[model samples]
Target chain A: MAIKEGIRTGGRSARVQASVHAAVRELLKEQDRASLTVPQIAARAGVTPSTIYRRWGELAALLADVAVERVLPDVAPLDTGELRADLRAWTEQYLDEITSEPGRNLMRDVLSSACPGYCTNILRGQLQVILDRAQARGEALPDIERLLDLLVAPTVYRTLFAEAPPTLEQLYSLLDLALPGQDPATLCHCDHRRR
Target chain B: MAIKEGIRTGGRSARVQASVHAAVRELLKEQDRASLTVPQIAARAGVTPSTIYRRWGELAALLADVAVERVLPDVAPLDTGELRADLRAWTEQYLDEITSEPGRNLMRDVLSSACPGYCTNILRGQLQVILDRAQARGEALPDIERLLDLLVAPTVYRTLFAEAPPTLEQLYSLLDLALPGQDPATLCHCDHRRR
Candidate 1:
């Protein structure tokens, strides 16, 4: 994160930016996202509140920058040659990542911001990775964009609002419904059907 | 509301509860949900903070009661006797309700609370109405429980996080994807396919 932040603008300005980003991340580790304030962030970073205000204008903007620059890129889906396997594996990992204390906080911070096209853009890219690999193997995939509603939205909803996040079993159940006749058991060793 | 509260208990206690709920709803009309504080709520409700604290213990618990008793139940999905039309109409109405300032605040309040099973309980009941009607008409449906992911999640996600909520057009697009063989145009007069 420091390297990426520093690479954009070298020297003291870059150092300040890195520190601010670092401070945001560090504070997130110890506290809820809603509790974070600009003055607190500035104090943690050893920069004046004016510096943060001048650079990012608002907490939301700073959080958006952190998301685009640091967080979303790390959420890229991996290629495993098979679409179903890749999706199931990716979904599990994605859930694990997002439901973690820091991950949930960071995601909530990003989503709560008014950054137009950020969530869909990052999600589309991730889904595209899985889709492209599926299409390469001559599998007839549905419209990649349409799959977002089926694949991404539910898990996100449960994570944010429901008392507990959707279990892997529940996710597999959704996949079974979405891709009828595409047995999830064939894709992975997990016997979610028994559950 | 007073009548409903009074039925549960009676007299001054019921009046106090009614006043507090009314105050929360009224205050929500003018301000964003995140900005509301317990002291402000107490002042508006014409009650002491100690009374509120003693009764509800925290802002989240109080908000959860408001959601359960008032907001969520009002989101009942209607039965138009046509599954696709009913789903679309319900989704649109639900979207309108949730995205409204007061609706959004109440929903955010309920979600941010530690209330277990509240979201799914309400949403499941709503979705079940549409599903039961669809099945009764001899339309083969996917697993009823899993449908929430496809039907409800995307709209909630876009409403809370995205720059814009999902349009009726985008929703039809999703329905088209979910119910592959069923044309939304055939079910309703709206010609989404031409788009």
Candidate 2:
């Protein structure tokens, strides 16, 4: 079943997916998300409701598919020549995006889906790019797993469940903790405490 | 509505809730979860299905309520006199419980429910007890929010989504990170790494 789906991801199927996703994005921006229905989405996408049902299973699954696409980083994280600067830049931008209202909704949709690994891998890949850049520059590399555990996990957990999102200072502190002895002063321009 | 529910918790309503929850727990152990229904649960508890629905709203919510009860730390975390030992003992026990098969299922039920905050607060409260104990001992207290972000968040994220649950060593390492300058050698008996 998985292979069959994989085989059909081109030409007509790909076009249908792209249009359907675009329609969902536009509709989500313009209307209340709770009011969205399959038929409305199909009409907007120039497809029948049956087409959506046959391809994506249901509204929740379809939303998850679109969310998975949106959350996946389309490009490498920005390179700032220094490891601390690069990590700060990438992490700050990441924190900003995921904690936004739309990003939180996307997170919920993706989590509700059967597959969360797709989004997890996208995040890990982006972090890996930054780590690789640091290594290439002969800077001491921070452990990726540590970064995930200490930084990404907290950021995500707080975003999803905590009363409020973590601040920029909190993010910098986490980065400092994750990469001990890395000079927190050089990590960010903000006047947060340096451990 | 909330006030009404609170007022009703003392008499027949409480008994019905107790019996239903007990029935659900028993049935879950004896049968496949997907096959069990409200009718079966109601029959086992000697109550009508309508009673279960009226009180709990639905099967998912009922399951979540039961899970929330199960996961709440019934007693204070062990006080081993020292701050590091107390943290290790509490966190290790927590990790062992929540990463088990039944624990994972309970986590899913709680998260799927409308009020994840109930479970989140329970966890935070448990950690706060550990921290408060440390403070009374004149031990420098680790920030509770930092502990939640660094320790609880990663433990949960890994339990819910990662390919594998984090190991005892990983938990120790996180504890070490969250409370830096604390002697890692004394944190856990296992020889993972000091730094």
Candidate 3:
């Protein structure tokens, strides 16, 4: 209650939210989602339970925030003049992040909640930057939005459903097919491309 | 234990599994994942808790089976002579299924599990059938495996992450780009094609 009653000191609110968010993440690692209580999170974060309840309303809402901001990696855009190289680099990076434990957990938690759109914004923002770079280089890309969907959805699908995450070769293969002039023979093999 | 021991009769095992599985789904609908217990599922299914524990071992495993077999819809392969038309029909069908509540739940549950490859086989099997048909018809398709990813992944990604699932139009555009010679002006609009 003391923390919540305190005056807003220019981003101090953000600092408090960050600490609460970090506490939520740490608690999650050690306990199951069902067992987690707002009071417990509040205690762990050194804030009043009312603060969490007032800010997030429910545990799922708080988890959604953590998933988007902290759990999902911030993917920087890559811009090689060639679309093939740029695409492979970006896809691999994206894949690696999502396949990690925290990444997978965040994605799962986000999907389970009522609002999946929160994660969508994060995914779209990252992919849009990459596509924008390719477009600037005069690549005759497909519908930029659709191109992103094509590039990303299957990996998520495979990752969620399949026994293994698609190999880097598989990602490169998809890019080759999506973009013109990149021969599959050269693109599908990650090892071949590097050499 | 008695239930499991008494299941050697014809179709009895199936009936018991079905009842147990149905009970699991019903219980999930009423409670969050963390709140669910084997005894609750067993009681709802009219079986002993030990039967459930012996069969599934954990809630996640049971949910995984349900997700793979029942939650995710069966996507039949489309075989329209034109690749553009076939892709549009297939994509729309797939999108509608995955974006639904059951589809979304199944996906989230599966992703939460250690093994994601299970869904990959389902996705791959459906896509492979479509690709093989296209190949048989001699369509100048992109790399078959990559084509599957390009066609399916982005839709899954956008559906899971974005505010709106990829529209039929977006899917058509991606297909148009992937398969040579289909102009976006003509493709990418399902409404236009229907008319």
lDDT of 1 at B116: 43
> In candidate 3, how many Å is residue A66 off?
3.0
- The reply for model 2, stretches above 4 Å from the true place, is A1-65, A109-116, A184-195, B1-63, B183-195
Flag regions of model 3 displaced more than 4 Å.
A1-10, A25-33, A43-50, A67-70, A73-90, A127-144, A173-195, B1-79, B112-115, B180-195
Candidate 2 lDDT by residue in tens digits, B1-195: 011221124688778878988999999899987898999999999999988887777787777777756765467788899888888888888788788776777766765666545556667777888888888878877778888877778887777656566888898878876674555343322223332
Superposition error at A85 for model 1 (Å): 1.9
Report the lDDT tens digits of candidate 1 across residue range B11-100: 898788889989999988999867989899999999998878777777877777787666455444777877778777876776776777
What is the fnat of model 2 with respect to the true interface contacts? 0.31
In TM-score terms, candidate 2 sits at 0.67
User: What is each predicted model's overall lDDT from 0 to 1?
Assistant: 0.68, 0.73, 0.66
In candidate 1 the C-alpha lDDT for residue A176 amounts to 53
Task: Report DockQ per prediction, comma-separated.
Answer: 0.30, 0.20, 0.35
Worst 10 residues of 1 chain B by lDDT: B1-10
Ranking by DockQ: 3, 1, 2
Q: TM-scores, in order shown? A: 0.66, 0.67, 0.64
